[model samples]
Target: MDVKLTEEEKIKVLNSDDIYGIMQKILLRESKIDQNREHFWVIGLENNHRILFIELISLGTVNKTLAEPMEVFSFALQKRAVKIILCHNHPSGELRPSEGDKDITDKLIQVGIIVNTEVLDHLIISTKSYLSFADTGLLSELKKSTKYIPQYVLEERLKKQATEIANKKKTVEIAKEFKRNGVDNETIALSTGLSIEEVEKLRVRKR
Candidate 1:
């Protein structure tokens, strides 16, 4: 558990223990905040598993913390992260996760799928020890419970889908315009990168 990282260094995370080692240093240095208060943090990771960023999403009282999926994933999206690791501290020094922990993890895993970012693991940390959902196989079990997804995540996913549909419609309209202008199917196909058959179909459909 080495506890040193330079500002420009990107740590490649191999497992849960790597995360726990990094967090250990953070807890040691962050003395301003009460060690007894719970804190929720998210580690953003690139496609290659290199660390992109670490962000503190929420802080709470002794036993509980509020970790919203929207808040968590917003940072991931902003950072262009392809995956994320969730970590939170329990001041009580109990490594066992609460029901709230499982529920939040389940919901975030669902949200992650919708957004194209994977939730690799969730960790519960104490001063002396830590618990890893992935290591214990709890993350696999949690992924099966897709009964609930956060409303915010659902709304954003719908918005993205709608935008994609609108863009495709606009592309079709442009192709139709080219057809109306007497552009040959071959020339239109070159301009729009559509196949000759596709351009012909578009022209026929517009009639």
Candidate 2:
């Protein structure tokens, strides 16, 4: 944990891949300390992806840990983290996500929305391998509320915005074609879904 970093020791995390690599090392180091029951860890990061802190949320039994959203988020909230990554160890060496794993991820994602913190991803760690919720499409299936949008949701919205812009450009072209064929501004508006003023501007351009 770079929590002890001085002002001169600023470590910038470039992206999710960077965090995943860092998390693997952190989990492996923690593994040496305890090889028994499961441990849930919460890692907080600033908007620029700088590490704020890493904390243990709960130490669970063989298969389960009671994790409340409030407890999971308490530290991140205190540190003013804009995003968080959830990491937990599986004693059984199974990389698969358990029911409890799924439950906490869902709960935390919703809690993040309410508190203005976004849950970027959840990682299931084992000594041999790791499973990423973002990689497996589970992160995409999380229930989102109107109150908050997670990073993955924001990426999706950006994609839609690009498509909408392309469609509007196509509509404008169609309107020009209509005008070229002697179509009225009212008719062009109806056919291309452009405003009457937009059609008039195109007509003036053609003239």
Candidate 3:
């Protein structure tokens, strides 16, 4: 007896993998945040076939900073994705959507509509479990009302933004101090994890 495989069957076989497990594995590989890291992730699907799971498209160390759609969608567009599932983890282990999260999700959904891609769901994953915005009917309501922003997301975004801004300021200060102390751009870059261009900018600013 002989066996043959069809093209569609071959494709399905090649793509056969646990989507949730794959996502968890990717998340595990990322740099573990302190008690406060804000992460934005997007999972792409093509005609009900999951293609990719991306993490930290835009991220911050604290709560106040929000992830932008452009950052999130850049990878999706690169992958030519047709549908998306957005997810973020709450370090606090709270599975509730914050105002900023809701606002961003709504904006993303609108953008998805404009770009002909569907925003299938937004999930809030904690250490142990997950909450789906669509499961709670929030997605449908957002499309209809367009006036809701959960407080949690806003707080989270603000925290992240504050942390990121503080880190950037610290980097600039370190670069300036290095320049003032007769440190070369290369040395400063190596010591501070900053680019040579950034160190050059600091040198120019110092002088």
Candidate 4:
């Protein structure tokens, strides 16, 4: 792919406010950008929080824009950015993130993890206002969401959890057997990996 940098002054981005200011400037200067249509942009950032590059990733209809992860990361990777923030305009002037916005952000976050490029935030901006996922703590919550975990990682976690559950069941069965055979609570606890209190509770339940 062809990558080129146009002449622009160096801009430092410290937070979401800085990003909003930059977006506002872009909206004013770029007459080619249709204000009636939704436009998605990927903002690449250096480790020191300076702007590396801003690439327009996609343009969609009035309310929705598509941001493919590959396309988003391509600019980020090409710029050698360590972090990225996603931005998109909503012609409807709504700040709330739609389900599609959340879904794409989640997918991009997962892809960013795989590609070693951290996704810092996703901004849904209108002419007058903006919503920041990171500022709202939605980004942290999205990281915890299990919807986009890689299949192999999910399977490995499930298998490990299953093994732990099976081992606990086996230990409980052994403890019950020891209790039935007239074994002392202390002996049952030591033999079956159960606490003495647990073995005593088992004895009571057997009555």
Of the two candidates 2 and 3, the one with more favorable TM-score, higher being better, is 2
RMSD of each: 9.1, 8.1, 19.4, 6.2
Measured with C-alpha atoms, the lDDT of residue 6 in candidate 4 is 46
Candidate 4 error regions (>4 Å): 1-9, 157-207
Q: How close is candidate 4 to the true structure, as a TM-score?
A: 0.71
Where in model 3 is the C-alpha error above 4 Å?
1-21, 31-35, 53-55, 146-207
Consecutive 10-residue window with the lowest summed lDDT within model 4: 1-10
Reference-based lDDT, residue 47, model 4: 89
> Highest lDDT among the candidates is held by which one?
1
Q: Compare the candidates by TM-score and give the number of the best one.
A: 4
lDDT ranking from best candidate downward: 1, 4, 2, 3
**Candidate 2 lDDT score at position 147:** 33
Tens digits of per-residue lDDT, candidate 4, 94-164, equal 88899899999999999999899999999988777899999999999899877998999789989999999
Off by over 4 Å in 2: 1-11, 14-17, 31-33, 144-207
